[model samples]
Target: MISFIWSPGNPLPAGTGGSENYTVGQVRELTRRGVPAQVVTVGLGTDDGRDDFVDIPFLSLPTLAAVGALDGTVVFVNEPHPVPTRRPAFLILHNPPPIREQHRAFAIEGTRDRALIATSRYAASLWSSYLDVDVSTINVVYPFAEPCFAAQARPDNRTGTTRVLFAGRLSPEKGIYTLLETLHIDVIEQDVALTFTATTAGADKPQGKIIERLLREHPAITVVTTRRTPASMAALMTEHDIVVMPSNSQYWHETFGIVSIEAQHSGCRVIASDDGGLPETDCGGVLLIAPDNAETLAWGIRAAIDSGPLSLSARRYAGMRFTVEQSVDTLLTVFAQPQPSPPATIIRQLEELILAPSVEAAHTVRVPTGTTA
Candidate 1:
């Protein structure tokens, strides 16, 4: 038996982001192959926001201690809580390492003795350097789009006005602000006949409310309800001609843009930033631009409009690229392999060497060249 551990107090979302979708897809695929797998949440009870995914199995434990006591292969998602397990455990690094020194210290401690899995090669390199571990010790398990995305069909005839959708969460890191700023430019507003749309995903957060308000007030952008299912999101993608992902590169680097592949699989062209793992998400229909720049994003949209719709051959290639089966196969291979021992002593020594005199100085401290915060 294998169990994926969701962090305590954090309810599993329906289909709002890549990590949630990846977890669900992994469990479902594992079950289909007769592997007993389940998502174990702590303290969420029945209120876990998994109403949209009733088909997926879930188990609730009273405490994190109980989760650590489970007799199975345990895989911790995102945050690696320090706990003793019956078997060797694994921690999947969904987000990049925290910027704060205290948080990084906790992460370093939690990662000891547990195998590490990153969602992309870029993420693997970033975490390996941050944790002072060998890059080969970290395994990559790329996230996949559901079958519904590849099955979505496009319209036979193209419209004169390009329909662009920002399908990511309403967060600043996802580059919704960049797209909004680009739309306000005189040149783009005057020259392009494009209709913009954004989803309400992630709008529940405090910061998201501010962005959501801006999106609703924008004259050219239409705000729509977030699609809670893969099939619904695929349908939404098929209706649009293009999708934009201007992930912020200054602070938050996109580990991997799942929306990029989904858009391509749905036969829509994608315009994403060039930094981080965004460039790796190309399935033959991605146009990369300078991250966090409105002018560059505007020009990228113009380029996509000029290129016309995605080709039939490109769409076919996308269909074969990132599938649930491929992702699960790679994950199974990693599970079967022996876990590598990361140099925890070296990690502690590096932390001590970099310890700063003040909190302000510590925040500014970063790893050496070829690695990032």
Candidate 2:
């Protein structure tokens, strides 16, 4: 039996975000393989958000403290929490953990037995360096785009206006400000038609209002601020010639750009920032731009428009490389490995990982390189 522990009270696949999509894909793939997969919702009741996955609800986190493990059971946790089970658990880290507070997690005692999994090689390296854990112990499991994002037939580019789409968060960290700057440049040049799909609402209402104002003022730009179903998003992606991902590395090294993969799957060429794991998604199909650079983004956008739609080879590569089956197979292999009990020294370091206040604090107070807290 396999179990996954996600955020408390939230529905499986909490949002259209990469991690949520991955969780739903994992569960569905596991079930397709005849594995008895279950999800432990850490809180009572389900939220409004939902996905089309095989939902299996089990006990919550608060109740796990007194529970005993079942033989042949394996658990995978996607969020930061005190280890919930002794049944050969694996901590699947979707993002970089809080830098300084990591040591406190080690003190939880339960985490000492859980193995680690990172979504990308870059993420694995970053976390291994940060947690003082042996890189060999951390498996790299690349997430696949949902099947809904499969390649679609593109509109004839012979005489059509170039359509560029940006499907992600409307926040500064996502490089939204840089994207806005690019749009301004594009509009002034009158080079290509633009559409911005803000997948999730911004952290603040002010940002949303600013984006609304920008959309209202720009005659050449269209904005999609509502959430769409996976199918709807895939269909929407097909209507565009290029997709933009200008994530800023200063605030957060985008652990993995799932939307970039999805865009490729929809046969859209990608204009991405070379931030964190963004380069890995290139697959010879991306136009790379420096993070937080609006001029370069504008140039890349115009370049993509000049180049025309994505080629068949690039689309095929993305479809074949970033499939749910491939990712699930790799993950299942890692899941089969015997769980290792970390040593006392490493456990001490992990405790620091949980306890450290922040990345800056970890660098200044403990590990000079901020590699290990």
Candidate 3:
């Protein structure tokens, strides 16, 4: 049995973000293939937010200690709790390291004795530098859009007005604020016949509520209910001509933009910020734009409107890429292999330096000829 451990206090959300979708997709695929896999949540009893995914198996534990007693390969999603496991463990780094020093220390400590997995190459490098580990030691497992996304057929014709959807969370990090600012531009609102829409994916949070209120008040943007299932989200994408992902680059770097690929799979052109893993998600229908800039975002939308709908061939190419099968195969390979050792601690490095032969000679610095002091 393989158990995917959700972070303590974070209930597994239903299709709200990449990490949640990733966990459920992986478990579903594994179970379909006759492998026993279940999501193990800590502290979130009964209300563990798997309503949309009733078919997926879930285990809710009252404490972290109960997680340590499980017999199987444990894959910790995002947060790695400092608990002893009966089998080898792995931690998937879904987000970048915390900005605070205390949280960084906690993450570093929790990472001990477990293998590291990152969602993208950029994320792997970021975590490697933060954790003081070798970049090669981290494994990359790209997220995928479910088959339903690719199966959705695009409309044969187009309407007079181009439709754009913001499928990400309503938080600032997802660049909802930047999108709001872009819609405020007179040129985008008056000159163009574009109908902008946003979903309430993250509105349960305090910050998201504030953003949601602002979105509802905006004249050009329409606030819609969040789609809780992959099929429903794909259908929503099919209804639009373009999907915008103005992800924030100031304090938050999007590790990977799953919505970009999902939109492309659903036959919608994607306009995303050209930063972090968003660039890597392109399957030929994406338009790269400057992040956090309303002007550039407006230009991107205009460009998409002018360029027209994605060609059937381009959509076909996107469907072929980033399939759930490929992702799960790579994941299984990682699970079967031996995990690399954790990064060496600072004290261990110092001890190694002290024990080295000719330690004083190792510290000697030779000055360049004719180069000063």
Candidate 4:
């Protein structure tokens, strides 16, 4: 039996974004495998809004504390708890914990800012160097893909050379600027069109400088700022042939990219930045490009587009790599980790993780480094 005490990305099932998608995907995978999986979330998230995944009563976060404790709970959280203490718990960190100056999270729980939430060796190195702690403790569970294959391929309604799409928050750190600026004059010159999809908050925010740059230069590319319901997002992704990720953030590394997985499950090739946890997305047929470089991104995009048969290959590759059944299998392994016999093992470990020495660092806060961070 595996269950999570989680807070949604925004509490609004659909609009809340990536973390919610993760929670739903994880829960669906586990339960389908016959493991009991529960998510402790906010009140029907009614005040927050709704999504296909967040609409149910089971996903609700209980207001009572005792109920949370009764279940052999595994706390799968995106952020650090301000108050640190132990009850049977395992944390699923979305952002790498900071190892620098103390921030607000220290108030909730005594968790190391630079604590390891590694899904790979490269990520482990970043945590050790940045947080000054042993990286071994960070769990290395590769993120699971969204579980919907309802989005089958379709004929391109727009006509001309068929193309896939990249949809997400278009920010400078997200590498949209790099991809748009560096695409070959010939490639940009091509009749290939683009539809950049992002939610309303990102559209309204000041962070969209990269998107602004893309719009200013590429008239052929259309920038879409409309928010989609969960069904809409699934439909949109399935309709396209490729999904592009051009992240170029200096500090905000993508911990795990669900968008890449969504694209893959929907039978789309994913062109992504070769940074952070994106390489793990390789398991799903993601074509990696150097971070912060536009020429490379454009080159990657063009290559995926030109291969003609690459889209079908990528879709098949992703299907082999990611599955709800495999995701559940991994979770069962995490849950069966010999449950520290000493009983207080978790409490003791938290003590050490919290006490690790701090260092001078960049922004210690973890925000939107990836789809669910």
Candidate 5:
């Protein structure tokens, strides 16, 4: 039987963060299909080892990696651990490792764990370049909505001038500080009620500073720093006409930008930097912003706000392209096949796995689409 071992991350059970939704949804889908899938979680909580997916937290990730090596037919939905676990595994690349990282070898070791399943084509290219290898079978599989964006409309545009919203990490790579600098210079919030949301408290460098200045300077603007909820995200998006993501690094680039997709699904126009996989959705969503430039981001957000509300067609396009069903279907195609060759062999350019399988295949699947948070 095909098996999977996923790593635990923040923002689950609440249907909030992108990675949380992706990992949870993927586990749920495979387990529903009778595949033996279990997640290697960290923080202790009620273990939900039911159906196709099981969340077990005891296996120290480092030790689990060694055990996973012998499973021979397991899939992973996260990074590589200290040792190669389970052969024929899938390593989901979220982003390139941070620059100036001291553990470059560890990161590369992690990359060598999967057969290479990139969430976005951009991610694949970035890894290849990062590792200086031509690891090409690395395919892209997008994520689905969290079921919140699919709900009824809840607009909060108050005065109709246009609601502008910026939400995501408060890190430098997210460009929130740059965004604030531009807003400071432009005085854009004079009429429009701008709102921002992010995880605050013990946040890195610029986020805390940006939020402080934003709240102090602009009373008209509301800044919220807290754990996010699906209802909150939906309320934010539906009420606002525009959503902005100013991701700075190409590695930091959005791998299938679920937030952007979900926002559009809620009928909010998206303004995102084109550097990362955010451009890969092919959802006909997002007004692409050049990376790291305050002028371009400000301009992009301004354009989204000034433009008319998203068309029904736009929402449908995003919802259709990034749905959970489509993502899992692509993943299942690999899981149902014969055992994938060892990463060691593949890394050496061996042709065994590249060749055709002995058996013939006759089935295909078409997954459904929907809106999400």
Candidate 6:
């Protein structure tokens, strides 16, 4: 039996976050496949535990210890929680963790029957280099778009004003501030009516005061504060001519741009900063912008506005590559693979530090032919 354990704080189904959505979709798809897969969620609003996925009050050590007693269970942990289980387990690395956090995680989780799974090749390479582990040992499993995120109908871009959208976090790293700066250039908003959807309210409201001031000052930019479901978000994407993700590399490089993929899948021409795993998500469905440069971003946005909605081929490529079916199939293949040896046994060579390139040099973007502006 395969069990997916989410954080004690996260909710299921109605939860708006990426990891939450992935878990919900994975469990549902697995159930449909007749796989003995279940989810262990918390704060689900129901105590009945009537669903195939069980609801626990919290993921305390006691709870995990109790779970350890279960037989024939293979666990997949979404968050960094050490399950005190004898059963084999895999840690899903959705994003890159800070060095201290990684150390703490390794200390608690140990290396036995525990293997790492990264969401992108960039992430796998990052972790492998940071931890001095073999990159090949870490499996790269790309996330999938939910059915609701698919393109229903492409928006006609020849209308009066081109509608441009900025979805996801309002943090500095997410480049909301940078995007705001781009508006200072008159060419950016010429025929474009920009929309900023506050999809995530960042960790402890990063740059809250500045973002608030930006939104208040730019009243012409439509602010969609209404909480959106996957279906609604997809519909919202379809309504827009272009979607921009100007992620900055200075803070945390984007691990994977899930929203970028979903936007493209919904036929919105995506313009993204080629930071970390963002290029992987964009694939053949985006216009690449160099990280942290407002001029380049503004240029990309203007180009996208002029270019109009994504071509039919771009939308089709996104749908085929980032579907739930593909993700689920890849996950099943990972599960079928034999258990990996402990990471502790792997030698960490000091020579790597002298040999490997600098961090900035490592995360540099090289846009592919079809995906570039």
Question: Each prediction's TM-score against the native?
Answer: 0.91, 0.80, 0.91, 0.73, 0.75, 0.79
CA deviation > 4 Å runs, candidate 6: 10-15, 42-62, 71-78, 99-113, 155-159, 189-217, 345-373
What total of clashing residue pairs does each candidate reach? 0, 17, 0, 17, 8, 0
lDDT, candidate 5, residue 187? 47
True-vs-predicted CA distance for residue 132, candidate 6, Å: 1.0
Expressed as tens digits, the lDDT of each residue in 152-244 for candidate 2 is: 566565545677776776666778778777766743356544444444434335775676666556665676644445667787788878888
Deviation from truth (RMSD, Å), model 4: 14.2
Q: Write the per-residue lDDT of candidate 1 for residues 217-278, one digit (tens) a residue.
A: 88888999999899999999999989999999988998888899989999999999999888
lDDT digits (tens) for residues 1-373 of candidate 5: 4444545442123333467567766766666667655555433333423222234222223445355444545555555654554345667776565566787877777666457677777777877787666756566676776566756475545574666666665566666666776675464645355554443422434655665565556544556554345555676678677778788764466666777877877888878888777787546657987887878887776676667788777776666667667788887875666534545657566566566477778778656677442
Report, for every candidate in turn, its global Cα lDDT versus the true structure.
0.88, 0.70, 0.89, 0.58, 0.62, 0.68
TM-score of 2: 0.80
Best by lDDT: 3
> What's the CA error at residue 11 for candidate 3, in Å?
1.8
Off by over 4 Å in 5: 1-16, 32-36, 42-73, 82-87, 156-158, 187-189, 192-220, 225-232, 338-343, 346-373
Candidate 1: count of backbone clashes, pairs at least 3 residues apart or interchain: 0
Looking at model 4, residue 337 earns an lDDT score of 69
Clash pairs for candidate 6: none
Off by over 4 Å in 3: 156-158, 344-373
* Candidate 6, poorest ten consecutive residues by summed lDDT: 52-61
Query: For model 5, what is the error of residue 13's alpha carbon versus the real structure, in angstroms, after optimal superposition?
Result: 8.1
Better of 2 and 3 by TM-score: 3
Rank list by TM-score: 3, 1, 2, 6, 5, 4
Full-model lDDT, candidate 5: 0.62
**Ranking 4 against 6 by lDDT, winner:** 6
Which candidate achieves the best TM-score against the true structure?
A: 3
Candidate 4 Cα errors over 4 Å, as ranges: 1-3, 7-17, 42-70, 82-86, 98-100, 104-109, 112-121, 128-133, 156-158, 183-187, 190-201, 204-218, 225-231, 311-314, 339-373
